[model samples]
Target: MTIEQVWAQYRQSLKAFLHTKVASPNDVDDLLQDVLLKTHLAIENLHKPTSVKAWLFQIAHNTVIDYYRKNGIHSNAQQEITWYNEAERNIKKELAQCIKPFIQQLPEQSAYLLEVIELEGKSQKQLADEMGLSYSTLKSQVQKARKELHGVFNACCQYDIDKHGNLIEYHQQATKGKCSPNHMDCTPGVRKKSDDKYAHCSKG
Candidate 1:
């Protein structure tokens, strides 16, 4: 069946599914559009026509999660926590896997700086002392390295962040843009170090 025919057959069921997750009619409509877009872009990858229903529902599920993540609305903490445990672990893995490759793509110095500061979890002051560079110089290099890493991620995917600045979802970009990097800089605000692993940085 054609894409339009497939959509027509499942649109009502999809709408009903979305309604169960989203309370706002307008938000549901918006999310349905997002699912439609993702479906259109990815349908050609569907190998089995018989699997269309499952595939469509998967897209709907992810779109709903993206919506809640973007809105920072966790209506069900237990459900959200379960979802987060699985999803966030995958995200961190993806981020870690991409790090070395992208960092190697940077200038040698910038690359080394990032490898030590970010991957090794070294303090900036210690790095500065070891390298015999002024703290200001080390800070500048760290920032530049971070920006370059951010560009690498941006080139790969466009991330969606919530109001509280937590990463919710990431959609791969169709094309590469100039290496303009943006990092997730989180501050520790009265949170213990153990509780604030992301206090320094978060790339999602």
Candidate 2:
């Protein structure tokens, strides 16, 4: 399909599909932008008009799966964040504002660990392997990092936690199963490990 036709026909469905999969509305916008940009560049390779929805969704699904593969979700929590008005956004943004100071105050190793494992979403095993550290060391680093992050949160923000002690905004999902970067990672129950037969670009 032509690039323009692809964008015109599939953008909204692609966004909705992503909205369901992605927890944050802002993140959904980011992912949709990435998908459409990639689709625009690779549209020439898509040959079937009738399959556009499936095709775009495949792209959307893979993009989000890759994010999880890299960043891991926040806390293994599945509940969605609710923001009904600008006031809510301001509150969440205010809560998130502590993030900067939290990162800056972290010791170098702790900061690096958080960036790699938390921000980048690599599995503990994957990160430990890459850093050439033993699993035990990596675990220690993660604990240290989380502890310091908590301290930063506590010191900087009154809204970081509720009286019940659960974090206010931490959200995460357990990956359904392992996926190789060399292959496609499907949704937990719906897909099994398979090669990326549909990816249009080699670099993705």
Candidate 3:
């Protein structure tokens, strides 16, 4: 598919396909980006015109599985938007109260770390270099900052309740060591959540 053709051909179909698999509109949007990127890359290597729809659908399937693999449908990606909306609906006043004072309570470095890393999406190494600190020290600071913010958010959970008025469970189920579908091995790269964080933790 050409650029124009790709958009025209796959946009709605991909959106609908992802909507069936995911839980929220936010997830739909994320998967849409994934499918389109895959489609654009595969468009160049098109060998069979008749199989375009199948090819695109296969990409969509693989993208959804990849999302489940990495983020595991249990991480921030799912509840990230849901929690934001839930806060907006049930507790705007409590949200402001907790966040404003918590920001003020953070140390200058902690505040800057949260802003740059959580809010602005800077990596730990980038923030460390910018602040003239060692990367290890910067990451340690970020972990501390995240722990503190998690505390504040947990405190505000006092106001967060379901229709039955019970506390909603919002913990992320950390991805397990096992990989699935094909490559399940004891080897380094074959494990699930086999990112650098695991290596660092294991060494420490």
Candidate 4:
């Protein structure tokens, strides 16, 4: 769809769609900007104009997922907006809630490394130079750190992947443990929580 049609037709619907996923009006407003930028960047790639509605909603849905990925579903991100119905306990929230704690489970420098590269939008080579490490060594460290984090998360949860290999849902299999999905309360992300220090950990 053209930018004109987006403004005339899809923008309000996209906002409404976002409201259903986001709990706070302020959060929803911020995500609207994110959705618009993503939509603007990707809109030209869409070939079928008739499918614009579904495409727009998918963008909004993925934007919500990214929001949760960036900011775990902790008290800070939660809000009581009467108009918004609590939609099915948000699989994304349940899935992302433990990410901060899991990252903490890693070594201190590992946590810092992931935060810089993944959350701060830093390139691995750039981080390597900044830290006075060789590029190849830094790349290997990044890969190893990611693997270690993945192994830790895998021990605590089992994901339900669809036929297309897309994650449809996930289940918390761990009881009382450090990596347990319900074990931590955190304000994660590089956005609103940036001022708190050591911004949290996710990318697109």
Q: What is the lDDT of residue 101 in candidate 3?
A: 40
Instruction: Give the distance in Å from residue 40's predicted Cα in candidate 3 to where it truly belongs.
Output: 1.6
Q: Where does candidate 1 have its weakest 10-residue lDDT segment?
A: 184-193
- Tens-place lDDT per residue, model 1, 1-204, is 444556667877888888889999988887775565455435545556776776677667766764564344665633642322232223222233335665777899999997776556566777888999988888888778868866765565454545532334444344322222443222111122233222212332
Ranking by lDDT: 1, 4, 2, 3
Q: Considering only N, C-alpha and C atoms within 3 Å, which residue pairs clash in candidate 1?
A: 151-181
lDDT of 3 by residue, 1-204 (tens): 343355555677777767877888887886775464334323444456666665666656656654564332433333332212221221222222223344444677777787666444456766777889987887788779857754543332212225432222222123242221221211111112223222101111
Model 3 residue pairs with clashes: none
Give the RMSD in angstroms, all C-alphas superposed, for model 2.
18.8
Model 1 stretches astray by more than 4 angstroms: 75-204
- Which candidate number has the best lDDT? 1
For candidate 3, the lDDT comes to: 0.47
Task: Tell me each candidate's TM-score.
Answer: 0.39, 0.39, 0.36, 0.40
RMSD of each: 16.2, 18.8, 20.8, 17.0
Pull out the clashing pairs in model 4.
Answer: none
* lDDT accuracy of residue 173 in candidate 4: 42
lDDT per model, in order?
0.57, 0.49, 0.47, 0.53
* Candidate 4 structure, TM-score to reference: 0.40
**Model 1 Cα shift for residue 95 (angstroms):** 18
The reply for model 2, stretches above 4 Å from the true place, is 74-128, 132-204
